[model samples]
Target: MLGDMILRAFRLTVRVSAVVQSSCQCPALHSCRALHSSPVLWAGHNKWSKVKDIKIPKDAARARMIAKYTMMIRIAVREGGANPEFNVALAQLLEQCRNKNLPKATIEGAIKGAKSKQGAQYLYEASGPGGCMLLIEVLTDNNTRSHQEIKRIMVKHGGALCEGARRNFDRKGVVAASRDGISSEKALELAIEAGAEDVQETEDEEEKPILQFICDITSMKAVRSALESLGVHTLSAGLEFVSHTPSLLNHAQLETASTLLEALNDCPDVVRVWDNIHAQNSQGN
Candidate 1:
């Protein structure tokens, strides 16, 4: 039902995001969040949003992939250094981008841009349809331009910039892992052993099952290490704004929320968008 309705948008907001914050109190960091209907409320997309992962053209997908990786690479360079050999994080990112088959020129260009001291990360908050809260993660060199653009996008899409949306969410650490051949019991066991508070199963665009482990933000790295030691293949480890209460949207609201997310993500500067929107269970109505 959702696939037919959600637009095919390009790259969007996620710092693994849409992770996370580095505690930069300076004019960076945007906020908004949730009330708690589910432990694992967001992971790339939630239950209702996942089915809407319809395919776009192969070229388009690759372009979007490249765009996302480009920003990620730039961020890594800005955080660490341009020299991947010295920056373990940058080296790992380069490997991941290579695995995605990002063009050599694109990778090189991102690295080159990082040396200019540009790339700053920010999050912007907005209220969407059904009053769903959204957090848009952005990576840009031009803060003023990006800010104005995001505000414009929000206004154009039935959304508006609003403060205090962050109250709805708890900033928690999230570790994504492979769910292949792993049962729920096994997932729980791993979560317990790794000191993760909870584990919820979701999927990628390809429908491959994924496990999202929730942990205290400070223990994020430790939890990931623990899981790896327990023989789990860790996909990515980062912080996320997990909602305490997910907003339940009616049909029209659901449709509008989907489009709003897509629109926010469409911005080239946007890294990823986090939200508290979930479809109202028809069974309950």
Candidate 2:
């Protein structure tokens, strides 16, 4: 159903706008001052947007792997047990690492490092225009480095660190799982039975159906355990800020917003970036 619809939609769009323009017009950059100052541009089709969109999924998957490894180390230490034989979340995260083809050496290093780590860490926070809350997750040994990097990026993109950005997002346990063989009806049923407060279909264009579940932080372990018991494979199970309502961005602003998201996400300290940005756009503060 989706593939046919996508093909039809693509056909309609391609038919309407067929004019191909090069990103760089001037062939001689040395003569043109504007061209000389500006970044290099590739000639021909404006298919970079499509390519960028495709790249996002791959980037997200890589970022998730990094976060997963970081989390595994933290979990191992917090549990006061380096062995996954006892700690379940650590065990689960390790399983995820294996599935992603992450190196066993990386996994072992995380476990070992966590055992030697000590003390509490700084948690950075930020909010975009219109209260689009962002939680900057980091595990760096240097707080200053993480802060400076995130602060620079956020300010550059019309966003700033908030005094209490954490308050904007409900302190709930958020989990993402793919629909392997289970039907949507059955998944929702299992989720609710497992104490999920709400389930939302994620905005993903992939083979598997993505579902987001919300639950109180305290009940998170139980919820995960319940779902796992039912044999439902969860892609990711972690905490997140669930938006009450997404802030809609205008078509003009959306381009910049996406760019900002990309820049912010590229930073190593930035583990997760959440926005309330919705589909509707209204002007003013």
Candidate number with greatest lDDT: 1
The digit string of per-residue lDDT tens for model 1 on 2-52 reads 654443321234343334444344333333223342345565356545445
Off by over 4 Å in 1: 1-56, 83-105, 117-119, 181-186, 205-208
Q: How accurate is candidate 1 locally (lDDT)?
A: 0.78
Give candidate 1's error at residue 250 in angstroms. Answer: 2.9
TM-score of each: 0.67, 0.62
lDDT of each: 0.78, 0.68
Model 2 regions lying over 4 Å from their true place:
1-64, 71-80, 85-89, 115-120, 181-190, 203-209, 221-231, 244-246, 252-254, 281-285
lDDT of 2 by residue, 1-285 (tens): 999999999998886565322224444544575675445454323357666778777777666657646754675557657767876567767766765667787777778777576434456677775446666666666777778888889899888887877665676686767656566787679878989998776643233467777888788777877887877667666656776756666665666677777787677655456766654535542
Best by TM-score: 1
| Ten contiguous residues minimizing lDDT sum, candidate 1 | 7-16
